[model samples]
Target: MSSVSYHISNLLEKMTSTDKDFRFMATNDLMLELQKDSIKLDEDSERKVVTMLLKLLEDKNGEVQNLAVKWQNNRHTRHYQWREKKPKYNKGG
Candidate 1:
C-alpha cells in the first residue's frame, strides 16, 4: 500500500483503541479526512471504516458515542446526496 493509504489505515485502527482519548483523536482525524473532497477510499476500506464508526456508536464513553453519531449522520448525508439523481430542466417551457 502507498504511504498515505497506510497512514489512513493506521488512523482507522486507532479509532477503535481502548483509550478513549486516542479514539476521539483518531475519529476526529478520520472525519476531517472524509470531509476532504480530494481523498477517496476503496470500497473495502470504506465498508470497514463505516462499520468501525457504527460500532463506535456503542462506545462506553458518551463523548465517543456523540462523535460517532455525528460522523454517521454526515456520512449518510453525503451518501444520499451522491446517490440522488438531479432532474433535468427543459428550456421549452
Candidate 2:
C-alpha cells in the first residue's frame, strides 16, 4: 500500500478504538486529509471511508458523530458530493 493508504488505514483503525478520544482524533485527522488537495482514495478506500462515516454518524461520542456528519456533508467526499447542493422543496397550491 502507498503512504496515503497506510495513513488512511491507521486513521480508520483509530476511529474504531474503544477509547472515544482516539475515534474523535482519527475522525478529525481524516477530515483534515479530506481537506487536502492531494488526498486520493482508491475504490476500496472510498467504500470503506463511506461505510465508516455512516457508522460514525451513530457513534456514542457526540464529537465523533459531529465530525462524521461534517465529513459526510463536505464537498470533497465523492460519495456525498451531492449533499452540497441545496435541497428543493415542491410547492403545491
Candidate 3:
C-alpha cells in the first residue's frame, strides 16, 4: 500500500480509540488529509473511512462530533461509495 493509505489506515484505527482525544485528533488529521487533492483511498479504505465518520457523528463527546461534521460536505466527492452506506444510528432512519 502507498504511504498515504498507510497513514490514513493508522488514523482510522486511532479514530476508533476509546479515548475521545484520540478520536478527535484522528478526525482532525483525517480532515487535513481529505482536503489534499492528492490523497486517495481504495474501495475498502473508503468504506471504512465513511463508516467511521458516520459512526463518529454520534460520538458522546460533542467535540468529536463537530469534527466529523466538518467532513460531511466534502465526503460525497471524496468517497463516491458513500451513497451505499447510510447512518443507521439515526432515529427513524
Candidate 4:
C-alpha cells in the first residue's frame, strides 16, 4: 500500500483504541484528513471510515460520541452541498 494509505489505516485503527485520548486524537486527525481535498479514499475505504465513525456514536465515552455525531453531521452537510452543486442528467426525457 502507498504510504498515505498506510498512514490512514493506522489512524483508523487508532480510532478504536481502548485509550480515550488515543481515540480522540485519531478522530481529530481523520477529520483533518477528510477536510483535505487531495486526500481521497477508495469506495471500500470510504465506506469503512464512515462505518467506523458511525460505530463511534455508541462509544462509552461521551466526548467520543459527541465528536462522532459532529463529524457525521459535517459529512452529511458537505455531501448535501456537493449534490446541490453537481449537474444532473435527465434520462429518457
Model 3's TM-score against the true structure: 0.78
Per-residue CA lDDT of model 2 for 41-78, tens digit only, reads: 88899888889989999999999999988887784655
Model 4 misplaced regions, further than 4 Å: 84-93
lDDT of 1 by residue, 1-93 (tens): 866578789988898789999998998888888888777688888888888899999999888899899998898789887567546689898
Q: Residue 69 deviation, candidate 3, in Å? A: 1.2
TM-score on alpha carbons, each prediction? 0.83, 0.79, 0.78, 0.84
Give the range where candidate 4 is weakest over 10 consecutive residues by summed lDDT.
77-86
Candidate 4 to truth, TM? 0.84
Cα lDDT tens digits for candidate 3, 1-93:
889989999999999899999999999999998888677678899899889999999999999998888789777565565555545576786
Local lDDT at 92 for model 1: 100
* lDDT measured at residue 80 in model 3 versus the true structure, 0 to 100: 68
| Residue 37 miss distance in model 3 (angstroms) | 0.3
lDDT of 4: 0.88
Which one wins on lDDT?
4
Query: Which scores greater on TM-score, model 1 or model 2?
Result: 1
